[model samples]
Target: MTATAKPLPAGWTIRLHRVHNLTVLTLHDEHGTDREIGFCPLTPDGPQDLTVSALDTIAHPRLREAAQNVVTSFYDRTAAARHHRDAFDRAVPDCRVLLGHLRARLPGCRADLGTDPNELTVTLTLTATTRAAGPLHALLARWPGHTGHGGSLADGIDQDLDSSGALTAALRQDRATEFLIWYRGQC
Candidate 1:
């Protein structure tokens, strides 16, 4: 895949650039543009190609975490990515359990999980705006399953969780006020 940019929290942007044999990672914002955050030399078949960590490069803890997620998306060779993909494969069944739980407790709530064809993005759509946020927070908090974190969503999904335990990044798409499953666990 070619170089791409993904939206970050607070109107920031993370850009991944693949130039020749090196992967250039940068963070962009209105105040500062294209600040180098991380870089990895491309080695298609080598063991160290995607295993490099940016902890030493990035000083800020929060920004480092965000940058790591973006950097990890550029590679699927890591064990974490493998674990994420495995869990993603079982999203349907896991979501079904969540759906059942939601409906059982909230009888009139309208909720469903929709997975994109590429399996990179899954939408947890709560159609009832009046009662969506509150119940969702409770349900998700009590959900008896593993939760994916950091770059587990992979690809381009945002990791920003709102006060209601919903992903605010999901609001960028569809324009509907819906909560998204920010961290999904294989149950």
Candidate 2:
């Protein structure tokens, strides 16, 4: 167990330790689940030797954003340009607008942004009961990743419920998903 914590995002803490000459960045959630984001080889220059890809693997969306600022600070001209371009290329255009519209369309529901553990992609998730499914399904019909090869919503959507008893229907793309609506039964 670690003694103290660092100034990270709310409810999250970061710890760094040396392992065989490498620095491993670990994150602890509110529940104290320790997740090893990734590790980088130590050098005389310290974290400046870290690459964009290596730093990008830091989990937790807020923590990732914080790490990106520090990681990109040491990048060279070419690396910095590539990092900027890749970031722009990975973003979903007008994402806030879409989320706002989603919230408006499904009143009383909640909408949130989700990122994969690897920080490679982003998703917009709408959490609602089956009562909102009809509207959500209609919206999904027009969006990409809505239908699988068979042209059925079920095909595209993950059929199984997650541990939280919610199923997600995602419109996946290269860097972002158009939408990832989570359906849960009413309480």
Candidate 3:
């Protein structure tokens, strides 16, 4: 059976090009130019073919690290891409739990968690907003969870949770003292 070629990693439109009869890795260019990045020489296998694993161990460490960085940077981008899901697999439940606890304290509280994308970048934000005030807003405004007021909602209180430490502090927050010491854990 013939070996089927696997597609290159995301953000990598690269292929093996023939440079002096040697297989060199090249990146795609909009002007149809081959930008040579690294070399992936082949073993003495008749027609001179190289495996994907073999190409990774090329002589150029910079090229290998560069390709790896391209792949690694995409790690977070794909986490929320499947089925249009939001948040990392583990963070989903934590977000839900925090939202639920806030809802219990303030029935009018609501949450929105998802990705914000532009022409070049994407970001994740998990926010909870509530119309209640006086004491409830003060409690959520603690560290880890950023609480704010005076938006379009007038009497609305906005809270955002971004780190696991903030999540843990939010979970343990039970009072609205004048100066409560919130532990953001090691997040």
Best candidate (score: TM-score): 2
lDDT of all predictions, in order shown? 0.43, 0.46, 0.37
Q: Residue 82 of model 2: what lDDT?
A: 57
Candidate 1 lDDT, tens digit per residue, 1-187? 1234333435555554456665555755546565335664652332222222333344434434546655455343234445544564454335555556656666545665454434334444553333555654455445332133651432333434455544322312221112224323312
The reply for model 2, stretches above 4 Å from the true place, is 1-91, 152-167, 171-187
Question: What would you estimate as the lDDT of candidate 2?
Answer: 0.46
Candidate 2 or 1, higher lDDT: 2
Q: lDDT of model 3 at residue 73?
A: 36
lDDT of 2 by residue, 3-44 (tens): 222234346544555455565555555566763354545412
| lDDT, residue 121, model 2 | 41
Per-model RMSD to reference: 15.5, 12.1, 13.7
The deviation in Å at residue 134 for candidate 3 is 4.0
| Residue 43 shift from truth in candidate 1, angstroms | 37
Ranking the candidates on TM-score from highest down gives 2, 3, 1
